[model samples]
Target: MNEFTLTADFGMTASDNGFIQYGIHPGDTIMFKKAEDFPVNGSIVAVIIDDGPITLKRISFYGDSLDCYLEGGSSRVAPIFISHAEYGRLKVLGVAVSVIHSLAPAEE
Candidate 1:
């Protein structure tokens, strides 16, 4: 059998309630690292929101927008709006490039 590895380039170093305010799925595993340490684009990340937390699909339009699609059986929510100030507050916890499901095959 082949071994699978899911690599995250950026993440948070410490546990911040602000970061976890967003709902985490029952089996979801989050990898924490620094947000700015990475290239800053084309990465899937968790964004902190006023109402809750969200996982961004990617950094769109030169960091002006955030794209996030639903995972697993979750339904799709509207795209998150990030203001310039808000964008600055976003700490890249890591770029989630791939996911390894417990019951399913690894996705990259």
Candidate 2:
């Protein structure tokens, strides 16, 4: 079985970066399983860009690249496109399995 970690900080990290949509709040707890393979299309992933802090994004594979979106589903947020060459610096920490939303209302 893949190991997973529950962290409220992970939610807060994403929230702090304006990933407050998709029901993931600053104080919410999240369960993330360690990535074993490249995620298929439309997987919610935790990625670290060029040694930067981790961020949660929905990734969709393109021909030789990928697009990362802050919010998934009906939201209209623009995606951040990553080219093939940049893949070397991108680290996929894991895939998100579920979220436990915070009781407190989110701050706008």
**TM-score of each model, paired residue for residue:** 0.43, 0.64
Candidate 1 lowest-lDDT run of ten: 12-21
lDDT of model number 2: 0.66
User: Largest lDDT belongs to which candidate?
Assistant: 2
Which number leads on TM-score? 2
lDDT of each: 0.44, 0.66
Model 2 stretches with alpha carbons more than 4 Å out: 1-14, 63-78, 106-108
- Model 1 residue 88 lDDT score: 57
In candidate 1, stretches whose alpha carbon ends up further than 4 angstroms from where it belongs are 1-33, 54-56, 62-75, 104-108
Consecutive 10-residue window with the lowest summed lDDT within model 2: 8-17
Candidate 1 lDDT over residue span 1-108, tens digit each: 998665665433222222233443333455644455543554456555454555444444343444322222223434444555555545444555443223533243
RMSD of 2: 5.7
